[model samples]
Target: MNLAEKIDKILANEVPFLEVAIYYLDFTVYFANLLFPLFLFLSVIWFTSKLANNTEIIAFLSSGVSYYRFLRPYMIGATIVCIGAFFLGMYLAPIASQGFNDFTYKHLKKGKKAYENTNVYRQLNENQYLYVGYFNVTEKTGTNFTLEEFDGPKMVNKISANRIQFNEADSTYTLFKYKERRVGEFGDELISEAKRDTIFDFDLDDLTPVKYIAETLNLNELNDFIAREKEKGSSYISRYEVVRYKRWSLPVSAYILTIIAVAVSSVKRRGGMGVNLAIGIAIGMVFIFFDKIFGTLAEQSDFSPFIATWAPNMVFAVLAIYLLRNAKR
Candidate 1:
């Protein structure tokens, strides 16, 4: 289905054939990294179920290999998987995600654009603040733009404009109906102009209010971005924090999910491997559902990102413990 869709898109958009391979490779890496732990969960279930069905596990146990001793190899394997997942999410996945999103937005989005955040506010420095009522990304323009510089508690200079547009060529801005009120030592000075072009200290690219940007940034970039947003009082800070914490939490879930899978599928039953696979699928779906529900809650509300990211694993760890005890018997 995806191949057919990509073919249609390539023909419709006149996308170069060279880009097809690049897009697929980046997308594959991004998607595989994103679901690596989930894949491990299901694979462990399948392999353990097969072993149980063959009674190989029973023979090993009968030969005096303790259940905990049997788990040593699985634990080592899980640690390797966990490290690989961590490395991918920290470094490789971010680059792949950026490429995939860039390709999609450029070729596949087909006139769709990210909606500009409204009521945008930023503190440029300890004493300077900026505001834009609305920004248009396609046009690189904004309405009701204001910049104010404060001296202690009182505002010293207030600059307002009816409209503002950024010039990418020279890294400057053009402001229409510009007015500046300056509080001088002598008295108040007011300057008004039909148009003005000036440069600000801040970068508009850094201030861009685009969604899903956190996912495309590497660990260092994400950390810096979150800190910058926090300093600027960005409303989407919670969303970025959730992404940050999940990078760590998701890799750690490899251990939790592995333990659960082994305990659930290592026992022989009348129905054989089929019954164990059914149970594994159900558990995997529940784990995914909980992660999504809580992660969305953290992004959309005031919920703690730490708890949102880790709660699902914590809940399933108890289930792993219970199942492990039963499997021992």
Candidate 2:
């Protein structure tokens, strides 16, 4: 079997039914996301072409109706679509993403050497970090692990365990068959061994770094995640932050695209829908490319994430307004 087929077999064998449902839900959401914007772009072109072909646009203009007035209904329709997109991105997405990640970790590649010698690590708080040499969420435990709390330049507390169990019931971590060392300001270290459960007030979700790898997270989760990562001063957090904000900002781009598509395609042409669809898709791609490019630049430079994320939308919206006004003239 190939790599993906092998991975699918492992997931099917280990993950729970509910978890699988969430994964499929996430897949659905991603599929919807990929198509919705293109559909909106096409709708704009189609409607505009219909108006032109039916001679309704010409009749409206002759009867003292301006292009601005003609676009009123279309704008309202686009606004409603944008609102739906907003709700999807800001609310339903987070829970679905969390469930999907849980399934992937617990079910996919369970008990298999999926990532050999790869210890997934994450900083939980300032000077506090968790490391898992091998994790199997199905077992709710990780082996060859370390949880450390630092004081300035010195390690103040350290927990070295053979396995750390996730207390999903309490949403915390319990170190099992573990030994812990505590060092004070004077460097006198105290060590203790525990065979039973040792509970620490650390959120296991934070330590499971792969949770962010899922593409379906909503704005709230993304915002909270970025803030948490930023506080820990983790490397590559800025890039994720840019992505988080971009998700929210990018959806409203549909409205701007709608206007531009309407403006460009409203004029009657002998070239027909083929020409209009081509131009609309081309312009739509340019906007998308610019949006992505600016987001990358935001991560690499001093530009604010919000500005970089919204810049393309702002630029396109303004251009649409200008073209729209000219269309009336």
Most lDDT-accurate candidate:
1
TM-score of each: 0.94, 0.71
Model 1 stretches with alpha carbons more than 4 Å out: 184-187
lDDT of each: 0.88, 0.72
TM-score of 2: 0.71
Report the C-alpha lDDT of model 1 over 207-241, residue by residue, as the tens digit: 45777788889999999988888877677888999
Q: Show the lowest summed lDDT stretch of 10 residues, model 1.
A: 110-119
lDDT of 2 at 76: 95
Q: List the residue pairs that clash in candidate 1.
A: none
Question: How high is the lDDT of residue 163 in model 2?
Answer: 78
RMSD of 2: 5.5
